[model samples]
Target: MTPSRPATAPGVREPAGTVTGPVGRLSPTDRFLPLWIVAAMVLGLLLGRAVPGLDEVLSAIEVGGISVPIALGLLIMMYPVLAKVRYDRLGTVAGDRRLLVSSLVLNWLIGPAVMFALAWLLLPDLPEYRTGLIIVGLARCIAMVIIWNDLARGDREAAAVLVALNSLFQVVAFGLLGWFYLEVLPGLLGLERAGADFSTGRIVLNVLVFLGVPLLAGYLTRRTGEKARGRDWYETRFLPRVGPLALYGLLFTIVLLFALQGGKITSQPADVARIAVPLLAYFALMWAGSYALGRAVGLPYDRTATLAFTAAGNNFELAIAVAIGTFGVTSGQALAGVVGPLIEVPVLVALVYVSLWLRRRMTTEGSGRGG
Candidate 1:
């Protein structure tokens, strides 16, 4: 059974991929997301430009190759959303072979290939930016897919299952896939690979610290919370309080990232514009293709929404961490990774409206199941 949607909280800004209310009742954070993102980007750039030597201070402190402040922001951004996941509900989703298999193919196989192709086609000459986009593709949606699913009234249980699966897979497959896409596939295609000498051990370690620690904490928190006070309290009462932290963490991270690289971004507007092209195509194609696939297979709208969203969204947090850890903080790769969410947040938010409209049309046509 799916977890019940949280009751609407007045003025409470749910995290990007975590909590959402019905469409008409979207929080200010949700509705004006593009504005907020643009604001965050602007603020960050301003901070860097205004304060001399600030970027140096921000980058000076580091833990595990990432700036300490940026790393903390990433952790804060991820934990609340991961905590909200109903990890126990995965069993319910596992039995749905069609949905599971479909998600697997869409997320792991076709999704990466599509991004790889787009990055090469659009930014063939810009290797650093291109590699960043490739990292974005390899990192599938463990975040924000749920928010899209919830907003679209998708299958919550399936969404949770898919997210959990992505999380687990990332710990293992991320390094391997990095090896393949960054090195092996390029060699086979006679394409010059990314110039950085990526150490797999380092990637894995970063994944463990960035994703693994938070995941374990989220799981333990849920378990302890439920056992002590039960699921209802854990979901409704506790979640609302901690959930807002996700946005705080996300915005904080963005600010720090921009503060460090603001000068580069402002100076090279054309390069940033170049990076945006492939990401725009990636999101649109993945969402549309997966949605069409779902309908072709005769799945209901809810699960189809889940599949489409899960397939379309990338884990920008992880991508950014990997980029920063592998490349330096100010590298073009990290900047490309940062640009990912700037595009994804607004695009997927718009898609939620599209999904709702399509749902209405399907109902009017009597194509809805059990209608």
Candidate 2:
């Protein structure tokens, strides 16, 4: 049976032989515009430059004195992340000893150690910017992983499991890693004395709003929608219905963030430039690590991409929250965290293409050997 197509923008058609399934696949536009994440970021820069007073306006416009802008942005970015999972995926993943062990080792054990080293080595001159990289790095494997993994046509089940595991790990590990790397080590390195409030309250609220609330909302929406109108119906009917809403929400958030950072980009061009090497290195190194481990363990190409992408991506959502609270909005540390999406979007898009190439090469070599 031919799958129903979502109405295309003018002059677009389904690719020849394209067949979407019950689990709706990504569209070509979704696949291509990851690079536009960078564009959205630049647009944000322009907003910040042109408005100059946008931040104050955002801050002043608050609900119960809490910043509405930050709150809305967090919700928009996080909801689709949680919505992607089925709880059964989590259970199945737990039983798969290999996936669990690999994820724990990559996310909890190795990722932070290397990130710390790279940040310091690369940005010795600027202590604050260096600390920001560590903050972003340590809070690894968040929403961006899901985006990248989905784009690479990863094993979504494995990706879901990995994301849940990493989110849990981040709560415990983020604080400890922040203290050790940001506070203690930085002191030892002669940067300033590092400090963290470790406001459990704030962290809990962030988890709730960013991770927990959206997760529950996504799950409930899925479950309720499915019950009301069977899985296939919901997949074919509703998800496609709301997909654009989620996509546009994300795009809008990116534009706002970039605009807020607009004025800073020119003045802080060096900041982005300085950390580019380590950020680039981190991406390359993590991709290699995940791929090598995936191959060594004999995972299939799709699963390997999932593993590699999950391990390589950073969870900038929590990182931004922590940075904003720990360092005030204008602080360099916060700026570093803010600059993350600006850098991450473009890099990940390129990485997606690279991952596809790697999969093809590996598959070809395997076939040749078998022949």
lDDT of 1 at 130: 94
Best by TM-score: 1
Give the whole-model CA lDDT for all candidates, comma-separated: 0.84, 0.68
Error of 1 at 314 (Å): 1.2
lDDT of 2 by residue, 28-61 (tens): 5454455666677778777787898987887787
Best lDDT among the predictions, by candidate number = 1
Q: How high a TM-score does candidate 2 get?
A: 0.79
- Measured with C-alpha atoms, the lDDT of residue 89 in candidate 2 is 57
Against the true structure, candidate 1 reaches a TM-score of: 0.90
Candidate 1 residue lDDT tens string, 307-327: 999999999988888888888
Candidate 2 local Cα displacement, residue 118, angstroms: 1.5
Off by over 4 Å in 1: 1-23, 367-371
